[model samples]
Target: MDSSDFTCVDVRRDGFVLHVVLDNPRSDMNAIDRAMHDDLTKLFRMLKQESQARVVLLSGRGRAFSVGGDFEWFRTLRSPHALAELNRDAKQLIWDMLDVEIPIVTAVHGYAMGLGTSIALYSDVIFMAESAKIADPHVKAGIVAGDGGVVAWPMAVGPARAKEFLMTGDALTAAAAERLGLVNHVVPDAELEERALAFARRLAEGAPMAVRFTKMAVNKLVKQALGVAFDASTGYELLTFMSEDHVEAVDAFLEKRQPRFTGR
Candidate 1:
């Protein structure tokens, strides 16, 4: 994919490794707006056809890995058509991320929240910075933790623990994330990117077909879960996006006040 093709993401090649950076146009937290979301859904599909990049190294170009859906985008979602499209895109994005055969190593810096947390955990290997954290704050915004949160979190941290954090929208520190199997390793902030790259390089240097097939073999588990839950989870999430409580939460967020959800 041409670097310019994806306005919100930057892509560069380093040997057989493709470096994909999440650089949100509006903010460093790399919030997901429609453009970013579309680019992401297209990314893995683009990579799947390529023989050049044996491995993908993903990271954010800012203080936070990502913070989730953009507030401005949230304010514009008054139309059912837009919501329906976004819901499908959300499902497509996760499936594509899982469908790719090349190994993906994610470098997590700062906080990875909502879709941020989903992408991070979906990576084949995750290297988190010591001070970084991960969470799905969708519920805090009065929405279901749709996307891959329902699938990946339970697989990583076990169902009981995943429910605790996902339901509460709580954050897990990098160390805690590693302990809970949500992340593979937690390195010092200074070494985070380099360590993640090293791992990607190792995968890139391996016999290409062997690495790709091995990745695909392991992803069967994830695909199985998606088959069972993706449609329902994203469906429910889109419904929540239309709720009065979701509107109040967004309003309260902008006004910097506690949300008064009347359970409508």
Candidate 2:
């Protein structure tokens, strides 16, 4: 495995399968920071160049899969321009994850919140632990659910459920999410990775063209139904990053307290 400043992303190959683990540790959950984002972008680019890579299994290294955007990373940015750049970086990461050509399966456990939830949702298939919690808490942080939520949620679970989740900033249990069609399956925590890898290997063993084409066909339909909403989400999320409320939200989270947002 190679290393970067954000060695948070660890990549390894076994036969035809690529195993990628998110390894950030500041939070029990691996919250995405700029460095980690860059690493993931690089990882995907490498994957895109690999004609022999048949499957990808994405998982987190710690107790929680991911807790979303890094609070400390947000706290360090004080300018509208800087915030916009950060948002774009994050948006691009999600878009790459969605548009990548290979068959990808995500194994989620513990917390999958904010952008983390979006990552899981965008995967070709998601296997989550029953103990996992997935939430789009961007509204709670005074930002739009821009990263993956608005682009993917309504398509996966219907517009009404999408509205409720984004509006309320509530966490959904893995079982609830599966029942609502947001996740593919919910298994025991111990079984999450095993199940996901097994599924990925199965896909990898199949005819590559058939699997890739089927995934592409379905994704095209989703993108068409969703229109250019992803572009809109990118703009809105960056705009919110310019807000005083956004900074305050990050500060509050880092300080371990409720944010007293002034809606600036």
lDDT of each: 0.89, 0.81
Residue 146's lDDT in candidate 1: 84
Cα lDDT for residue 128, model 1?
93
Give the number of the best model, judged by lDDT: 1
- Per-residue lDDT tens digits for candidate 1, residues 1-264, read 758879888999998999999998788789899889888988877877777889999999887889888877887875799888888788888888888888999999998999989998888999999999889989988889888899899999899999999899989899899998888999999999899999999989999899889889989988998889888888888888899999999999989999998876
Model 1, runs deviating above 4 Å: none
RMSD of 1: 1.0
Candidate 2 lDDT over residue span 144-256, tens digit each: 88776886788888999999999889999888999999999999988888888889999999999899889878878766654578777767877887788988887787789
RMSD values for the candidates in order, in angstroms, are 1.0, 2.0
Worst 10 residues of 2 by lDDT: 1-10
Off by over 4 Å in 2: 1-6, 225-227
Q: How many residue pairs clash in each candidate?
A: 0, 0
